[model samples]
Target: MSPVRRGEKLPIYNRIGVLRAERKMTRAELAETVGINVQSVGALERGDNYPSLDLAFRICAVFDLPVEAVFSRTEFGAMSAELYRRPDLRPEPQSDPGGAR
Candidate 1:
């Protein structure tokens, strides 16, 4: 894995496994619905891989949730699309002088 950039991280989901589990749905079911492999579902559940845009929409369709309802961004990284929330609007100062400060 590469070093975490200022705005990037291995985005952990807010609710994929949790939601599916709540609905008594299996990984295979989600995979089929999203047109991905069950292993991919397992990977997503473990934060091992990120989903494609089409897959994201598919997941949302299955859950009847708005994109925002499923994704939430955090101070460090973005949340899964299925659980994404609004990003912070507060501004932060940038560093200079070779990031000495």
Candidate 2:
């Protein structure tokens, strides 16, 4: 394997941590479910290592999510922020309800 440069960006990013938290799953639990070591799970979550195709499929199966939802080449932002961002539907500023100017 080639050494990663200090400032090099990862080729792929994942939502494993977010998905695990959403499901209240631990690294150990996810590791066991995916037939991998807990350390490997940590590495994957940190983007220190990429999973093989089979391993990726296993992880997706455990989460019951499509691979695209779990992994992406682009960075994934917070779902709440993304959902609330609406340049086309901005809310009008409200005036003070009190009579004071």
Candidate 3:
């Protein structure tokens, strides 16, 4: 049986790291503010792990950002085109903010 990969391509959300860098915050300080362990905060920044919804909320609150600003949902058709490098693989053209192809 073939293995099934689930979930959208979770494009990296290093916004946490961006926030930390902008604030010149240590991982320990950020973790303390977010009520998570320093290692968890480090992992999230490094993209070594994905955040749970609860953690996402906490991080967003800490950074004072709406969730959409911090995270993006992948559209499968876009992922397919990008991964395959085949423009023909894209879905019926939608209104793209990056400008229509």
Candidate 4:
């Protein structure tokens, strides 16, 4: 294994595993759909290998999503967090609640 690089441009994170789970699709299934092998699918999902532009586009097409929706340069937050963001997590308004400012 190679050392993990930080603050660099090479790292790429993806939501392939999450999307596959949502659709109940197996690695082999995805591999077949994308014209790759099972091991390559695993590699992509594990972030051990990066996909080429064509492969990335193919994967996005498989999920009916855009490239950014499937891949990111930074780490992704929890799927649920993105799906159901809490109102309380938002920045509070600066106005006085009691109206006595």
- The candidate maximizing lDDT is 4
lDDT (C-alpha) at residue 101 in model 1: 46
Ranking by lDDT: 4, 2, 1, 3
Per-residue accuracy of model 3 over 34-67 as CA lDDT, tens digit each: 7889999888877788888887888888878887
- Give one digit per residue, the lDDT tens place, for model 1 in 1-101: 65777776656464687779779999999888888889988887677786777877788899999766554453223335425766878889776869674
Q: Count the backbone clashes (under 3 Å) in each candidate.
A: 10, 0, 0, 0
C-alpha lDDT score of every prediction, in listed order: 0.73, 0.91, 0.73, 0.93
> After best superposition, candidate 3 residue 13: deviation in angstroms?
2.4
Tens digits of per-residue lDDT for model 2, 1-101: 56887878768789999989999999999999989999999999999999998999999999898998889989998967876986877689888889666
Give the 10-residue window scoring lowest on summed lDDT in candidate 1: 73-82
Pairs that collide, model 1: 70-82, 70-83, 70-84, 71-82, 71-83, 71-84, 71-85, 72-83, 72-84, 72-85
Clashing pairs in 3: none
Q: Whose TM-score is higher: candidate 2's or candidate 3's?
A: 2
What lDDT is obtained when candidate 4 is compared to the true structure?
Answer: 0.93
Candidate 2 clashing pairs, residues 3+ apart or interchain: none
lDDT at 83, model 2: 64
